[model samples]
Structures are given as structure tokens and as C-alpha cells.
Target: MEKIPILRMGDFLLVTIQIDMHDQLALKLQDDLSNAIQQHASKGVLIDISTLEMVDSFIGRMVADISGMGRILGAQTILVGMQPAVAITLVELGLSLPGVATALNVERGMEILRRKIAADGTDERPG
Candidate 1:
């Protein structure tokens, strides 16, 4: 399979993690995120969950893995647009995301990333 796609929006590296409901995408996640952080030098990461139908234990483990790897890669991972039902199911299935950063949506996630960048004095808004 091809490497997962990761895009950059401001200081956030937007990761649209690709995976089947029952498959393992963790190693690919690590590789793709490694490329993203290296390529863009971003301060944060966002996983768009609006496209996911179900997140199982394996995926949850992947999320935790990505979060830890992201920290070492110099980016904090965040989950965005996670459907409440999916979130509930993940929790009910005993899957925790291991302190990965999370946001209600991509916009919020970008804001968080921007805040982090700004805290580091990198604010350069286009006029």
C-alpha cells in the first residue's frame, strides 16, 4: 500500500489517517508522520476523524503510537471531528487514545497549532 497522505495547514500537520476498520495502520502511520514532520517542520498534528466509521482497538493502539512518535518528531498529535458515537464506542471498547491532543474540528485544531506557534513567536498572518 502507498504511504498515508499528510498535509500541512499553518503550523498543524493535517493527517488524514487511512485505514480499514479491521486492519493495522500503525506502522504506516509512523512512517507517514515521520515524513510529514520532517518535510514541513510543523509544531502540531491533526487527525481528521470525520471520515472514519469505526475505530477499533488496533486503531486506538495506532493512535497512541502516533502520539508518542509525534512527540519525538516534534509534533503533538490531535484528533479532530471525532464523532461522538465513535468516541463512545472506542471508550466502551476499552480503547483510550493515550493523551493525544484532540479538537472538535480541523479549524479548532489549527487554532491550537497556531497558538503553539505563536507561543514560540512564529505568528505571520497573511494580510
Candidate 2:
């Protein structure tokens, strides 16, 4: 089975989805990310899906679920780099991806996460 790499950066977890997603891979990501957030006490999650040109209902739901799960585990989730068509397809499919915050790119996503962490007074990084 293939796996998506989740990198830990300070109080955040970054996930770049560089491959086509399947049911199993999505499930694994959800499980791995849940564990990682708890293990690292991460404050945020940034997921970049720029490489994916398309999305189905399952994938959309998975993304939404990941965001919701992160929130439940005390982490803010930001999705970034979504292609225009992919977004349209998701809306057309009626998968609005509720509760998931999005940004145009990784940089913007990271900024959003940073602001969120700072506002929450959870910035534990050393200066």
C-alpha cells in the first residue's frame, strides 16, 4: 500500500498530496494524521493538494473529515493549492467540504495556521 508523507514542522503538520488518492490512502492518511496530532501535540495541519487535478465525492468527504478530525484533536486544518476545476467539481458534486479552511497556496495556508495558533495563544515554539 502507498502512503502520503506527513512532515512535522514545529507545532504543525504539513501534508503535500503528490499522488492520486484512493480510498485506502485517504483512510491511512486520516489515521496517521490523527495519531500524529496527538503524539506531537500539533497545533495545526496544512494539507496541499495542488498536484491533484481532480476530486470525487469520496476524496472531498475525506478532506472534510480530516479537517473536522483535526479540530476535534485540538489542531486547526488548512487546505491549500486547490485547482479551480477541482473546486468546481467538488461543488458540483455537492461536497462543500464544510468546516475546512482553504488558501490559495502553501505559503498562505501556513500564514493562516500561524495566525490561528498565535490567536489561540498556543505558540510553544522557542525563539
Candidate 3:
């Protein structure tokens, strides 16, 4: 029963997946992230998945769901750090993660999220 941590950084939430997540853990993470977005009134979510070597359909769907949920909550979601092999496997497994924003690393992800929030007129002022 591993719990993923959601860290708050200014107007964004950072979710760093440090281990290969299982089904239950992934679901819990999705729930936690949604709650954090609302609780913090976050403008964005950056998920770092660099440590994961593989992802199943369940995990892939969870990631997609998290992105969708973030959007519904008025937050932008960026998934970062996907290894090339892992990404290829996800595509081969038919999980392209449609409508999800991806980046090569956390730095780029933050830049994208910030730009999207600004473009959406989210008013990301210091609180």
C-alpha cells in the first residue's frame, strides 16, 4: 500500500511517481490528485513518471483520467519523464493517452503548464 505524494509548488501541484505503481496505488493517486487540485485551487498539475519502466492499461487510464479530472477542475495537467521504450509500449498497448499533455522533463512540463494557465486567463497571482 504505497502512497504517492502530491507536493504543492506555487499554483501547481507536483506528483512524482518514484516507483512502479500498481492498480490500487494508481487509483489512489488519481483520487488524491483530484482532491489536491480543488483543495489548493491549483492552476496546474505536473506528473513525473521517469522512474516507471512500464505502464499497463489500468495505469495508463488512470493517468488519462487524472488529466481529464484536472481539466474539469480548471487545472492544466502535464505528464513528464516518459522513457522512449515505455512510451512505445504504451502505444503498442493502444494507450496513446489522448488529450494528455506530455513533456520530456519536469522543467518543460512546468513551462507548458504555466503558459497554458496564462493563456486560459487563470490569474496565477501570488497568494
Candidate 4:
């Protein structure tokens, strides 16, 4: 099973999804992300889904779950690089990802995360 690499970036965790993940891999990513959030005490999470060509209901739900988990762990989640068609399909499939925040690209997402963390005044990352 291939694992998604979660990178620690200052006060955030970055996850770039490049491949079409299977169920197991997705589940593993959720677990790993949660653990990383707790271990790092990250202030935010940025997930880049640019290379993901398709997103079914399950994957969409997983993304939402990740966002919710991040919230519970005192981190904000911003999903980026979602293609227009993918967004439409997700909405059509009834997976609007209610609790998740989104940005057009990674750069924008990073900016959003930085601003959020700054406003919150709680930098969870250890020096």
C-alpha cells in the first residue's frame, strides 16, 4: 500500500494527492493526517488535489472527515486545486463538503491558512 506523504510546513501540514487513491489508501491518509495534526500540533492543514481527476462520494466524504477532524484537533483545513468539473460532480453527488474550506490553488490556500492562523493567534507548531 502506497502512503501519502504529509509534509510539515511551518505551522501547517501539506498533503498533495497526485494519484487516484483506493479506499484503503484514503483511510490510511485520514488516520495519518489526524496523527500528524496531533503530533505536530499543527495550526492548519492544506490538501492539494490538483492531480485528482475523479472524486467519488467516498473520497469526498473522507475529505470532509479530514476537515472535521482537523477542527476537533484545533486546526483549520483548506482543500485546494479542485478542478471545476470535480466540484460540480461532488455537488451533484450531494457531497458539498459542508465543513471544509477551499482555495483555487496551493498558493491561495497557503495564504488563507496563514491568515487564519495569524488571526487566531495560536501557533501550534513547536519551534
Candidate 5:
């Protein structure tokens, strides 16, 4: 199984998650990404989950955890490319995320991150 990948696109780390119907990968993804986000603190993240058919309770919690952790690490985390069905389901599940912005697409998320980084005067590549 391929590990869930998070790609660095300009200032925002764009991630596209692929999960099977069985929902086996969510836990590992959370643990790995929690560590990865902590390691790359101060870098914004944009997650794309449009491909995901559904987001269960466990995965939703993990995502919410990442959002909070990203803030603590001085990074702005955003969710993009979420299908309407997934979005509605997440809302109904009472999944809550703190400090995580949602965008319609990767480009919008990246734009927001750019403005954020520019305002903070931080270079995307770091020193």
C-alpha cells in the first residue's frame, strides 16, 4: 500500500488522500501526517479529498487533530477538493475542525497560503 502523500506546492503543502472503501489507511495516515506536520511546522497545508467517497468518524478525528496540530506548529492547514457528498457527510457526523480553512480547489488554497506567507514575510523555501 502506498503511504498517503502530502505534496509541497508553492507555499501550501497540497495533499490528495486516497482511501479504499474499507477505511484501513486512515489511522496510519493520521499518525504519519501528525509527525510530518510537526516536522514541517510553519509550512501551510492544503488537503484534497475529492476522491474520497466518504470520511468516517476515525478519519475525521484524525484530520481535525492535524488541523489543531498544524496551528500549534505555526502552520495554516486547509482542506480542499472535498466532494459535496463527503462535505455534507462530515457535517452530519459532527466532525469539528479548528483553524482549518476549506477551499474549493488546490489553486484557491495555494492562493490563500501565499497571502498568508507574504503577510508574515516568510519565504516559502525557508532560509
Candidate 6:
């Protein structure tokens, strides 16, 4: 089974989806990411999906579920690098992905996460 890689960057978890998403892969990603967030005590999650040209309803819902799960785990989730067509498909499929923040790229996504951490006034940086 192919798995997506989740990297830890400071107080955030970064996920870059480089391959096409299947049902099983998406499920695995959700489980793995949930574990990572708790283990790392992540404050935020940045998911980069720029490489994906399209997204089916299942993939779209999985993305939303990941974001919600992150929130439940006490981490903010930001989705970045979404293609225009993918966005359209998501809307067409009625997946608005409520409560999920989005960014144009990884750099901007990281910035949003930093701003969120600052706003929360609970910096997890090591002294």
C-alpha cells in the first residue's frame, strides 16, 4: 500500500500530495495524519495539493474530513496549492469544505499557520 508522507516543520505538519488519491490511500492518510498530529503535538497542518489536477467527490470529502479531524485534535488545518479545476470540481460536487482554510501555495499556507499561532498567543517554540 502506497502512503503519503507527512513532515513536521516546527509546530506544524506539512503534507504534500504528489500522487493520485485513491479511497484506501485517502483513508490511510487520514489515519496517519491523525496519529502524527497527536504524536508531534502539532499546532497546525498544511496540506499541499497542487500536483493534483482533479479530485473526485470521495477525495474531496476525505480532504474535508482530514481538516475536521485535525481541528478535533487541536490543530488548525490549511489546504494549499489547489488547482482551479479541482476547486471547481469540489464546488460542483457540493463539497464546500467548511471550516477549512485554503492558500495558493505552501509559502502562503505556512504564513497563515504562523499568523494563526501568533493570534492564539500560545507559541510552542522551544526556548
TM-score of each: 0.81, 0.92, 0.92, 0.93, 0.78, 0.91
**Sliding window of 10 residues with minimal summed lDDT for model 2:** 118-127
Error of 6 at 7 (Å): 0.9
Q: Candidate 2 has what TM-score? A: 0.92
Instruction: Report, for all candidates in order, the number of backbone clashes.
Output: 1, 0, 0, 0, 0, 0
Q: Candidate 2 residues 76-127, lDDT tens each? A: 9999999999988888888887788999998999999888777777656643
> Which scores better on lDDT, 5 or 6?
6
| Better candidate by lDDT, 1 or 4 | 4
For model 5, what is the C-alpha lDDT against the true structure?
0.73
Model 5, position 39, has a per-residue lDDT of: 65
Candidate 5 clash pair list:
none
**How would you encode candidate 5's per-residue C-alpha lDDT over 8-121 as one tens digit per residue?**
554456668876634556666766666776665547877788788888787777678778777777778888887888878878888755456888887888888888778778
Report how far off residue 75 is in candidate 2 (Å).
Answer: 0.2
**Cα displacement (Å) at residue 96, model 3:** 0.9
Candidate topping lDDT: 4
Better of 5 and 6 by TM-score: 6
Model 6 lDDT per residue over 1-127, tens place: 6899999998999999988887898899999999999999999999999998888888877888988899888899999999998888788888888878999999999998888878778756643
**Candidate 4 lDDT, tens digit per residue, 9-93?**
9889999999989999999999999999999999899999998999998898899999999999989999999998898988898
On the 0 to 100 scale, the lDDT of residue 119 in model 4 is 68
Cα lDDT tens digits for candidate 3, 19-103: 8777788889999999999999999999999988888888888888999999899888999999999999998989889899999
Could you tell me the TM-score of candidate 6? 0.91
Which model is ahead, 3 or 5, in terms of TM-score? 3
Candidate 5: segments with Cα more than 4 A from true spot: 21-24, 38-42, 96-98, 122-127
